[model samples]
Target chain A: MKLNIALLPGDGIGPDVVVQAVKSLQAVADAFGHTFHFEEALVGAIAIDKTGDPLPEETLAVCKKSDAVLFGAIGDPKYDNDPKAKVRPEQGLLKLRKSLGLFTNIRPIKAYPTLIEKSPLKKDIISGTDFTIYRELTGGIYFGEKKISEDGTIASDLCEYSEAEIERIAHLAFKATRSRKNKLTLVDKANVLETSRLWRRVVTTIGKSYPDVELDFLFVDNAAMQIILNPSQFDVILTENMFGDIISDEGSVIGGSIGLLASASVGSDIAMFEPIHGSYPQAKGKDIANPVASILSAAMLLEHFNLKEEAETIQYAVEKSLEKGVVTPDLDKNSTYGTNKVGDFIADFILHAE
Target chain B: MKLNIALLPGDGIGPDVVVQAVKSLQAVADAFGHTFHFEEALVGAIAIDKTGDPLPEETLAVCKKSDAVLFGAIGDPKYDNDPKAKVRPEQGLLKLRKSLGLFTNIRPIKAYPTLIEKSPLKKDIISGTDFTIYRELTGGIYFGEKKISEDGTIASDLCEYSEAEIERIAHLAFKATRSRKNKLTLVDKANVLETSRLWRRVVTTIGKSYPDVELDFLFVDNAAMQIILNPSQFDVILTENMFGDIISDEGSVIGGSIGLLASASVGSDIAMFEPIHGSYPQAKGKDIANPVASILSAAMLLEHFNLKEEAETIQYAVEKSLEKGVVTPDLDKNSTYGTNKVGDFIADFILHAE
Candidate 1:
């Protein structure tokens, strides 16, 4: 099989992590007897510095031509601190998602046994926790019509949802649920908001088609508490854009290191994989940042194309690395490996996997 | 001093816990040499059972006539399970908030040392966590306009925040911040939502008035993650209505048990205090429900009245109860004390404090 992948090493530690993910991808390709081609593109703060645009026209063209995009990270301290700045690095990623119609973000939170003790949560409470959050990316109040009065006293945002919007994501969640634990929990404030009520109605009707998947509802407030109290109780969580943003980020803490979580944003035709962590400007040139999240993102990119064995190989290598304590300082302060060494170890493990 | 308080024990363990709060309030009144007058009103499922309305007109009248309202939990399995039911207990609380114009909901989360081991989080991580969430109530999408398409296919809720609304809550949070840690964190999704941008503009301007209080900002998504990762970092959290609802509930876990969390809703003139826990139908009439949250609500009520010494006395007595192992089973699995016994112990302690 031949695959075309786009690499967007945005800014800061983005370049370091992307290099590691590319090496791991190459290793996966070698072990699986597959051919993979990569194209590099400029985005985010680096793009702004080079071309005066966070996402250049050529960068978007390269992404459109690729079968998949592996993103590293986006952000810069310069842009982050200046609230008055009209243009920033994060805009590039948001625009790319909108341009490519990447409307659904999938984040899987799992408590690895080897790292469970590292979690802020007690081992007994977090051991069995594993769930994925399917967050609607492009709709809801976040993108709704916003208005401010002439005097700047009143501001309003309209949170609108159509049957089509809810159905598109509901199908993904319900189908995924059928394959996993056969349970789908929709998190919304249905008791209050019209959009949430619509979510319930649409998801409930859609669930009838997938009889094997059990469907349930939880208010967002209760869902937030439950994520901390009993994360294992959830299998697949479906929520609107804003609720999804909050809940999925909250889920990121379940595994202890935000640096270790990878996310995938996909739509009907396009998919993008990236580490959820931000680009640490302080660690940009140090080569000490963790590369596991980047490597796992490569795995998610493979799984997006039905390459389950290849994906599992990458996952296994990561687990083995953690078990052997071959990690960066973020996970183990005493470990001697830097970002590149950790990447090298994982690639070597992946290539040797049976 | 003379005080007129309204007591609304909605359903299930609501009555049980409210009884304990009343007892504690009486103890505070005696210690502070104050005359307290109590009036009772019906709301929630119980009110629906007798009056066919959740928040009856007379009930609102009673709350209006009071200096403050002390509320217990509200909800029953009968209403929760039946989604198609037109009348529900939560509607009563929502209506009561709207009727009384209670626009600010304040929830304080403290990691009590005696109960640190009971938390799902590692003790070291949560031991020093203490913060309050000032949630803008009676606005945002919850009370926004709702519309459903004639074809039952589309729905939308408008999330509007006036500068007046933002300023009202921001002032409260900023003022409180000065008296506390002199640090205020405004949580919003400014990059995405128009309402959030308005919030930032209004709050930033308001921050100028309180030069002693340091102000910072956090996106709702990052705020949720930070709550779990480093809750101790927050001093006072101010947020819009819906974000507040989700974040505040998420904050409840920092302290361990939802049964020990209490909240206060205050507007320009009226304030209502209630436990953050729901009415547990299973524990009704069993005398096993935890009453600490309700007792703490009474403590918050005293604090709201500028009776700082009286509030601290109640807080001190409650701490003494936890130290003496006088809590119900929720805090201690080996404990034999019932809800009433625990309430009596705290009240007894409060009345005898030097």
Candidate 2:
């Protein structure tokens, strides 16, 4: 098989981590006897600095012509604190999603046995926790009409969802449930928000077609507590844009380290994979940033293309790395390994390990 | 001091737990030599059942004519699943908050030493966690305009905020910072939502008046993760209505059980107190529901009226009950004590213990 991957190593530790992911992918290609080509493009803060636009026209063109996109972190502290800034780094990623017609984001939260004790949650609580979150990405308040009064004393954002938007994501979520434990939990504030009511109604109608999957609903507030109280109760969680942004980040903690979580955003024509962790600007050049999340994202990209064996090899290598204690300071303060050495171990394991 | 209290023991375990709170309050009144008059009113599902309105004019009148209100839980399972139902038990609470001008909701999340082991979070992560969340209650999306299209194909909810609403809550939260750790964290989605940017702008300007306090900002998604990663790093967290609803509930788990939390909603002229936990219909008549949250809410009511000594007594009595292992089934499954027995123990301690 041949694959052309568009690599967007955005900013800060993104460049560092994406280097490690590419190493693992190169190793996978070598071991699996596949032809792989990688094209690089500038995005986010780096792009903003170079071209004054976070998403450069050339970058979008490259992504559109590629088989898939492998994204790194975006956002810089400078743009984050300036509430009045017109052009921001996050706008780049948001535009990419919209331009590519990416409608759904899937994040799998699984507790690794070796890393369970590192979690803030107790071992017994997160031991067997395994769940996935399907988030609607293209629509909602993020893309809604935003208004500010002429006097600048008032501001508003409209959160709207059409049936088509909800139906597309709801179908993906229900289809995901069948492939998992066959339990789907829709987390929304249906009791209060009109948009949430539409979600509940649409998802409920969709659930009838997948009668084998058990469906349930939880108020977002209650769902927040339930995530901390008992995460094992969930199989697949479906929610709107804003709710999903909050819940999936909350669910990211169950893995003990945000450094180990990966996510995939899918559209009809293209799919993009990225780490759930952020830029971590403080650790940019320190060589202490964890690269497992980016490497796992590469594995997810492989699985997206139906390269199951290649994806599993990368996952198995990552598990072995954790078991052998070859981790960055985030996971183990006493370990001397940095980002490069840890990635080296995984790539080497992929080439030689049975 | 003489005080007139409105009691709205709403539905399900609301009446059951509110009775325990009354027992503790009566004990406080007797021990502290205060004159207290209690008035009962109908609200929530029970009110809808009797008067065909969730918040009847009579209930609002009772609350307005009283010094303060002690609210129990609301909502029934029957109203939860029916998204099409025009009348919901929660409408009672929303109407009551709007009518009474309850704008700011204060919830303090603290990890008690005796109950720390019961928390799902590891001890080191949640051990000394103590923080308060100031949530804007009467504004934002909950009170904003909600609309569904005639064809029911599209739905929207507008989240709007004005300078005055942000200023009032900002002052309250900043004043709170002076009383404890001089740190305040404003949680919002400023990078995306226009309303959040207004919140950041208003709060940042108001923060200059609070020179002694240190103020910072966090995006809601990162805030959710930080709440689990390191809860002790916060002092006072201020956020908009919906973010607060989700965050404060997530923050509730730090104390080991939601059953041990209490909250206060304050306005210009009126203040209401209630347990943060919901009405658990399953435990409604079982005599197995925990009563500590309701009792703590009564203590907050006393504090609202400048009855500091009386409030301390109730808090100390509840602490003593926990320290002595006299708790409901939720906290200690092996304990033989029931809800009524636990309330009796707290009341007995308030009356007799030093």
Best by lDDT: 2
Instruction: Return the TM-scores of chain A for each candidate in numbered order.
Output: 0.98, 0.93
Best by TM-score: 1
User: Fnat for model 1?
Assistant: 0.92
- Candidate 1 chain A, poorest ten consecutive residues by summed lDDT: A171-180
- Candidate 1's C-alpha runs over 4 A off are A82-86, B78-86
What DockQ class does candidate 1 belong to? high
lDDT of 2 at B343: 94
- Model 1, span A1-354: residue lDDT tens: 799999998998999999999998999889999999999999999999899899999999999999999998899988889979789999999899999999899998999888888888888888899899999999988888889889888889999999999999999888777657999999999988999999999999998899888899999999998999988999999999989989998899978877889999999876999999989989996979999898999998998898988999999999999999999999989989999999999999998875
Q: Candidate 2, TM-score vs. the true structure?
A: 0.93
Error of model 1, residue B60, in angstroms: 2.8
Per-candidate alpha-carbon RMSD to the true structure: 1.8, 2.7
The digit string of per-residue lDDT tens for model 1 on B113-196 reads: 998988888888897898999999888888889999999888999999898998988999998886589999999998878889
| Model 2: TM-score, first chain | 0.93
* Candidate 2: pairs in clash: none
The digit string of per-residue lDDT tens for model 2 on A1-354 reads 899999999988999999999999999999989888999998999999999999999999999999999999998998878889889999899899989999999998999999988888988899889899999998899889999999999999999999999999888889887767999999999978999999999999999999999999999999998999899999999999999999999999866888999999999888999998889898997899899999999999998888989999999999999999999989999999999999999999999974
For model 2 chain B, give the 10-residue run with minimal summed lDDT: B77-86
